[model samples]
Target: MEVTHAVEFLLLVLLEKLSWSDTKVVLPDANVTCIIPEDCILPCSFKPTSTVVIHWYKQQIPVHSYYYNKDQFGLQNKHFSGRTCLFNSHIPHGNASLLLRRVKVQDRGRYKCYTSTRKHNQEMFVNLEVKGQCAAMVLAPVYLGLATFTASADCFYLFAPAQLWVVERAPIQTVTITMTDEWVTCSSQNVYPVPQISWATNPPSSQHAIENSTIRTTDHKGLFTVESMVRIVGNLTSYTYLCSFKSADKTQVWTASWKNQEDLTYEEGHPVLIPCNAPQMLRNFSLTWTFTSSSEPTLILRYDNRTRHTVNQWEGQAELDQDLVLLGDGSLLLKKPNSQDHSGTYTCTFTAVNTKRIFQTNVNITVAATSVDEQSMQRSWWSTAASAVFVLFTVIVALLQCVKQNAKENRTASHRHNGTGVIEGGLLLYMDLNPSAVRVRPHGAGAHEQESSLVTGPDHCDRTLEPSPEAEQEEEPAEPAEEANEEQRDRFECNEPV
Candidate 1:
């Protein structure tokens, strides 16, 4: 037993030496992007060696492990069940990357990949960041100037903590020319750090030449909305106007011009192309398209020197002519125009990369209903005509039924009159003197039982009339005068002879 214990101790020491010998520590930091419920790979590799053992850990928790020529999942964390995997075939090549499936929010953390072999050991570190799902940006148009310029844009982010900076944007900016004064008003909303607004006139005017008014309001979100107005005191012939919104640092400025405005029209269902030609002199300039109608204006698209971004609602609907955009033809192609909503004014803005000068052009779009809508309208008219004819036929049939029922009632009344005897001049003149008893029948008595008699003697025929069950069930009560008249007629007939 002593010898056996001695041999076992020697074998353990040998195993320890084999585990620690030639251990190479390789600590490299890696960055990985992981979206929720998607798979991500944490990369870690080392020099190939024999009989490899790999382990992946999140902080101190065991995520996954590979040992004894197979994957050892029994020691994996419960949160990673059925979601952790490693490339077993690559193990021989010293590639021990951990593949995490269905990534959760909790999966964001520092990860360590430790690999060991009979002669070598190495480890690598990785940082995982979980982000939300990605989506495309949508753009609308914002309208500016008298010629109906509109501009709009849609923006989306691939990760959280996004930021938006509008150098100068206004939803309700307008210029009006009146008999007395020329006025220009500009308004912007949802801005941060309190932007500044100013006005400049062409041919250079003094500060006293224009009257200015400004208002600013802030919301609970700590963003600002501003409105600025400028009026030329007297009737001015023709002067150019510019409105500018400058950043607090004065490094970035947005300008709106009143001189460069144009009008355009297009039919529905057809594509529209608004031309924005740029001179060869302009370089490193950005182009933006906006739409403005009777409703609010919106940003449609923005093309910086490199890429084109489409704003909300206009994604996939608006696109720049890629081949011609760089050539200074910043024309936009609008697909399948809708008359009710798309008919509005569009604006194209060009800003130089280094200069504060801005150029703008306006296009008015008019979309009418297509031939399909007209066909549907025609079908509606035919359906209305058919319904009218059916109603007229139903009314005519109802009238014919009423006329037939009235004619039958008139015939019945005439027959009843013919069956009754009339007393002349309100005098009961006995035509028959037979001393027979007269029987008076009720109103609903059968016609075959009807009898007429006359009795001239002093003894009169006596009888009482009782309403039948059917007559008692009637909702309306009979008049007393009619019953009395009936009784008098009975008495007069009874006094005469039958």
Candidate 2:
């Protein structure tokens, strides 16, 4: 009887173990993406027939717990002490989600949530992915050989591989008469899921086709470094050349281009029109006109398929025809072109919609001075001469009038000698005669009578004097007496005295 009882006890224990294994917990694996220094939720839930106990663990380390209708985190890990919390309110509804705050790089791993009910036990798992910030550096093109250039950039990511690309440009590369072959290289370093590179040209050429080569290298941190090179063997006659770098998944692409030169000429005072029409019209495009000279490149105008923008210096002097633009003519018109400084090279760049290709046209303009400028200069000289002659004539007239007035004043002052005697030939003479003091005197009169008889002079030295009536009568009587005395004296001289 003892042996039979032992066998039955062993069978009962085996049967209980088999029944527990048959009731497997239905928990699915999940993935969650979270940024560094932010919060995340590790989701887990189970259907419980009664009150349950929930616990969250990070890689077998206890992070948080929930029991007795509240969060019980006494046995939480040190790394997740104040940063872990369980949803206590959802405990009765069989939810055991864990909220992690201020997630750090070390928090990236697997997590598990375990729940225990009165009837069964269950658990769930979650995978966490943390992404940190990254940086990229693009270097300017370096000339490797004659007509050969290389463009490169370095990109790095913290946790995972980064999407990278390379932009190649030839801002001012020209092929001289002595050069034979030309080459351009575009490269990207420390990238994952390697990028694609291609080349294009305006007025596409077959003789100057692109030949590509790539080299893959690895860093100490297991990052990828891809170096791409493109070579052009024969002569290039295209107006523009383009190079593009695209990722394998086609989510990111970078591009650059080079342009050839053209010449244009215009005369001063005439309107200047620059043609910039593309061969094919796209639904959306961008057109920019830039003036390049000794100074910095000035932006003249920009048309972004929607609106037209004119720069400050070119506001009133430059304009675009909207009607012509609608008809696929992207031209710039300058009115009254007068500045010699405007004679320089101009660049017109066009970017199409939904593509990485760029088309650039360079127009070298020369403005010659017109005949109108010469005529204006001559007229200005004539006006200046006329003004100078008029001013000189007015000065001469004023000087003459001043001299005549001074001479007249001096003559009047000399004639009217105000109380001072006149000086003539070094002799002072008193010529102020009294009119009442002038009288005529007889020849043989007494001294007193002679003194009383005064002589009168003429009114002026240049005029003749006339006699008065009294003087005429006295002269007649004197003449008759002279006649009678002469007759008696001739007859008897001594006897007439007795």
The model with the greatest lDDT is 1
Q: Least accurate stretch of 10 residues (summed lDDT) in model 2?
A: 170-179
Over 1-498, each residue of candidate 1 has an lDDT whose tens digit, in order, gives: 657655744653355346655657878699998866579999999777778777788996778877778886655678999999888888788789999997866688899887777667777899998754533333443433322211223121212223222222222222222122456666566654455778777756777775567888955333467777888533343455666777554555666554343556777677877666654445777787788778777888878765544343487677787777777787778887667767776766666642323334444445455676898899999999999999999999999999999999999866654535334443323232232432233233222222233342466434333333443334134453455545545654454322
Shift of residue 274 alpha carbon in model 2, Å: 1.6
The regions of model 2 sitting more than 4 angstroms off are 1-32, 35-192, 207-238, 250-258, 307-313, 352-498
**Model-by-model lDDT, in order?**
0.61, 0.58
- Can you write out model 2's per-residue Cα lDDT over 364-429, one digit (the tens) per residue? 444455566787889989999999999999999999999999999998876775434554543243
Winning model by TM-score = 2
- Clash totals in order: 50, 2
Q: What residue pairs are clashing in model 2?
A: 439-454, 439-455
